[model samples]
Target: MSEVMGQQKNNLELNDNFEDHDSVSDSQVVDYLFAHPDFFVKHAHLFEELDIPHAHKGSVSLVELQSEQLRKKVRLLNYKLNQLISIARQNEQIYRVYADLNLRLLATQSMEEMQLVLEEVMQERLQLESVVIKPFIGAYAFPEIQRRLFVEKRFRRDKFFFGRLSEHERKLLFPQQEANSVALLLLGELGELGMLAVSSKDPSHFNPDMDTLLITQLQQFLSILLPKLMKY
Candidate 1:
């Protein structure tokens, strides 16, 4: 009975915590700021602070309540608005990086040329990051050269890395990160076909939240392009 009571108490506490968070979220101060982006620059700080919990001291007089509430409203709204602005800036930068990459990828006429050009683009476009062209492993080869690369056992075997690695033979061809780094495939070809890895001293630089479509499309561009380019 005691154990059961403890579990019940724990559940109650969790439910209460959830309710408090929901109440704060429903305050909608941050939402209003986001909807009107123009107000953000002046009131961003308030929202940022309000994102976390704030307590009213018990000794505070009721007269101060109005000002206190206003401060909280502004603080939380400011933080959230700043976050949105930051996201917009980051997305703009990522788009530019891919745009620069596409320009170079389309210019290559052969697999070797593409590799050189892609790596050069990744380096210049993404702060000297290293890139690799990984063909699919453990699957049927469309043509002859890929079969040879497979037979030669030239592949990096890591499922943590993604993109086009034909459902079979996959390997790491180029790398610049440390022995232990969490990498996000920000953009690439398919079957690990065309992949990019950015390295930084900060271990969290490559955490999983990054968007990978840009790199994925790049991989797609290379998958067919590499095979056709080899002929030239």
Candidate 2:
């Protein structure tokens, strides 16, 4: 139902004939949202888990979730055979971006390349229209949670108070000048972070009314994938 999710469904839908292919259905996504509101709500513990959804819960484990619930959610998110194909296609895009940037990164040898990879991830993985990943001004050298405050503050300000502030409020709080850009942070080998943010020349992209699920999924994606990708 969220734009990103909608695009995800659309991207997956573009794959092939639905007559035989099992596919992701919009109804299933809606059903989960209606049934499992708390299950989908964002939590910090998610950041600690690394097992990919379909992979066996290996030694590098994620929190044991309600297995059936997770299965349904994954199934719903993934849809059917064609959707799985779409998911594969999407990953290929991610790898291509990663491969190209990895080569560039090796030559450039700049830590900033990681963030650049994130910029590419936004386009490739998440499929947003425009993206900019400004490093947190003091975040680089700060302690782990210190940088988090900015994200938290931004979320809380948008959430607890407004609960759904209009688009105007988002711009004032997360403006480019503050360097409060939403980015997927990489500590490399240690872990990664995913951020949800929008942009606008029209000024409505950050509007308070926007759905928070966008942010929630970024964190969720990191929760499931970051630790698994870490080197042993």
Strongest candidate by TM-score: 1
Which window of ten consecutive residues has the lowest lDDT sum in model 2? 157-166
Q: Ten consecutive residues with minimal summed lDDT in candidate 1? A: 179-188
Error of 1 at 67 (Å): 1.5
TM-score of each: 0.49, 0.28
* RMSD, every candidate, angstroms: 17.5, 27.9
Candidate 2 per-residue lDDT over residues 1-232, each given as its tens digit: 5999999888777654564346658797689768877763566466366554645653443444456568988888777777889978976775675456435434432335544665665555555433533233233343446446544554443321112223443443354422222332222222223332433334333444544443544434434443343221
lDDT of 2: 0.45
Off by over 4 Å in 2: 1-79, 109-127, 136-232
**TM-score for candidate 2:** 0.28
Predicted structure 1: lDDT: 0.54
